[model samples]
Target: MSISAPDVTPDVTPNAPWWRSAVLYQIYPRSFQDSDGDGIGDLNGIAARLDYLVDLGVDAIWISPIFPSPMADFGYDVEDYCGIDPRFGTLADFDALLAAAHARGLKILLDFVPNHSSDQHPWFRESRASRTNPKRDWYLWRDAAPDGGVPNNWISDFGGPAWEWDEATGQYYYHAFLKEQPDLNWRNPDVRAAMLDVLRFWFARGVDGFRIDVLWHMVKHADFPDNPLNPAWHVSMGEMHRVLQRHSTDQPEVHAIAGDMRRIADDYSTPGEERVLIGEIYLPLERLMHYYGQDESGVHLPFNFQLIDARWDARTLAQMIADYEAALPPGGWPNWVLGNHDRPRSATKRGAEQARVAAMLLLTLRGTPTLYYGDELGLEDAVIPPDRVQDPRELREPGLGLGRDPVRAPMPWDAGAHAGFSTAEPWLPLGADWRTRNVAAERDDPASMLSLHRALLALRRRHPALGVGQFRLIEAEGDVLAYERVCGDDRIVVALNLGATPHPVILPPGAWRLLLSTTPDPFTDTLAPNQGVILQPER
Candidate 1:
């Protein structure tokens, strides 16, 4: 009897599609690193950390904003769409960062502020020059109220009225964030073309894609009708949330604009690869999927924020998982995010000690996982002094505690002065106990949350089932969450204990083998508190 071995030809390099099995790590640039000793992070700092990112096993990086801005709302307020801020280094620094990133097999995606521009932007300046200016229609401007007051009762996200009175033009300009960040009139053809040109400029510079900021708010009602008031007086940060925002944002026409933006992205695509366009949408699931469009012609991935909204229950987790999987377009890829600069870090939200469990869930989920800066180190929210509050919303609504500055503090890189983030007085104060939570300390400890993250990401890279496999919810009771990831000949069951107490989970009896776990000793036949287990199904 003769035995034959299966023939294995040379593995061809797979074409890298934008959304297929990609892990995107979002870098809040200003808080990521500082190289110029200016007490603020810049592109140079990001370039220096390419190896750190490459070692972490993420496929790509999505940097928040480094574009030229007045820093009114950080970099979300774009002053020059095609230019890099001097504070963040010159355009050459960005080009070098892109080059170095690509060389290290990392793709770079930048934040695109399409919904609005800094009031100081030349276009906005031109628009506000006069009612008859050629660019007067670039931004959303309307006449004063009948009572000679400001426009409508629409509230800005940063607090105060959405419309700002422009004395020179005798009209009010609309801004959904800050008065200085005027909303662009997407209704205007010229404005659309100009925004597209901004995309082209970066694409030509070798940018992989864009994470559109406030994407759903690009289009507003042509009539500029006052938004209906919300009957529910929900309070999160302490401010009275009385105003209803029905008509001001998330308009239906936003989809059409998204489709157009998709077309613009398509124009810049390579042979068979898709250009990435991730929309920063905060709407409910039903409305969120619309950004992808029916035929997958809109945004590549409208961020699924289920983890952000989930309350850490087996039932909630199972249902949200099913709903999100069902909501995707046939070939549409899914993405998961637990934290961002705008929201509280998952560590703080899920209890500082439970951060490991949150990381396990985020990494094992059936989609690209986005890890916010400082999250891997289990960094908690900083305590922002009332006098040092920078967020306009927090200033306006003093009692709400609604500001985002706490979560946007400098990353703890070392135990040195300023945590090695900056030599000068840091822009934001470092978190308390930085000595223990700093990256330097965590890098040396194999049991640290940072090390666990690195191990999980490494495991994810080796297992295709975790990256692009179909997710099946497995049966589990109480706070135990179980799921199976299957891809072709690979299959693995991932069980997670989201509670503080150890939970026993009976495997679907087979040749069960532990693949990975957040617990220090997962293979010891013990499930520790907030432990996670990835078991290979027995053949």
Candidate 2:
């Protein structure tokens, strides 16, 4: 059956926080829309599409980095933290987007890059000018090893040594990622003070929150010890994974920094505007929970990426959800992400049908859920011909299937030329099935992927159980995953069939009201392959 997007007002308990159950939609700016036909999506283009996002029933949008940069690593290498890139329009454009989004009951979050600065940034320029420069200690600079080799054997996330030798300064500077991006010295008080002020600059402009980039990598081991080598390391996984990153990330002192960020966000929040800090941490649940801090003075949400890294199986996912639920610290809210720019789309990793089931799992699970762009259309990774590849990762490590360009394709808004994303060619190629898979085509078809997302999002808002409920695994075996979500009087039973052939689930006896089905029409018997449904007491 066709469904309209539901009213997304908070239906949880009166005092419940918005982000606790909020569904955030991550916008890759370059791919979202192009207002001026510059072959790139900009802030003005995003503002033009605020109505579409509101119709999608998401609570907020997390835009990827759009700061001024050389685009060496996209906008992650920030040259100016306070100013918007000329390509993304001026600060006036950002203000307009913020105003438009807020008018629709939606929040906006800017990507905050705190761990590093672009090598071209003024701070880095000064630091590299000479050893005695005032800003020299603002970044990590160390003398070469006794034999004149690079210091400490740390490898860059892109490729090669993390230390870059500067002939002028007679020192090597540390960069965790691309050499163009120099790691900032969070250990230095002046660096800490300046970065925190950057937060204030934005908060004063009325941004709702920040998704801090590489939050764990901000604080490294003080002793500069070499990370222990991993026995299972392979060259294909990138050179940085050669070690376990024990000395580079998940440090104990990072909690204090997280608390400081939370305090900064809290300071600007009014009664209506409860600002938040979401840390982009990739550690295991045990260590990831620490970012929440002991007294709830840390990040509001440390992104949970278990769904992205886990083996796509019924039993494995069931246990992962259970374990993650158990591991959350007191007062720590859980979050889940199916895909992002760095990873392959969930639809590509799993088949198109299973992707719908995965979407069901993401929206109905406990805590906040982040929906990646184009996921609602069952968009998979586009095949980027070698000559057309734009991602440096693929260029640096050829033929490793590590390139992120495929998933960063422009949004297929319509069947028009350029798929209504741009008048000129897109920065990255659109999915091959753009004509059939575009939003305009799917919006009219009752059984289209877009309809299923609308239905599920409607169900999540209509029932409190699915959003802020207590969870319990009901069954997990034989390619079937079942669970119950309960919130006082509201109880929802979600059953998912993971296998290709029809799988019968012995649902507990009850008068069941079918709330939603992954399929278009009502089902009478067993669930079709990759089908899932939400049921409530048929009272």
Shift in Å, residue 469, candidate 2: 1.7
lDDT (C-alpha) at residue 335 in model 1: 84
Provide the TM-score for each candidate, comma-separated. Answer: 0.94, 0.96
lDDT for 160 in candidate 1 is 72
lDDT for model 2, on a 0 to 1 scale?
Answer: 0.87
Query: At residue 295, what lDDT does model 1 achieve?
Result: 88
Please give the range of 10 consecutive residues that has the lowest summed lDDT in model 1: 1-10
lDDT of 1 at 66: 91
Model 2, range 1-539, lDDT digits (tens) per residue? 11111112333656666787689999999999999878999999999888888778899999999999999999999999999998889999999899989989999999999999999999999999988899999999988899999878678877778899899979898999988999999989999999999999999998999999989999888888888888999978887788778887778877888889999998997755788899999987788888889879889999999999789888878778878877777777778999998999999999898899999999998889999999999999999999999888889888888899999999999999999999999988989999999999998787888988888888888888888877777754678888888887988999898888787776677778788888764544467787898888879
Candidate number with greatest TM-score? 2
Q: How much lDDT does each candidate structure score?
A: 0.82, 0.87
Per-residue lDDT of candidate 1, residues 226-299 (tens digit): 77776776766232246766777788878887888788788889854457899999888888888888687789
- List residue ranges in candidate 2 displaced over 4 A: 1-13, 520-525
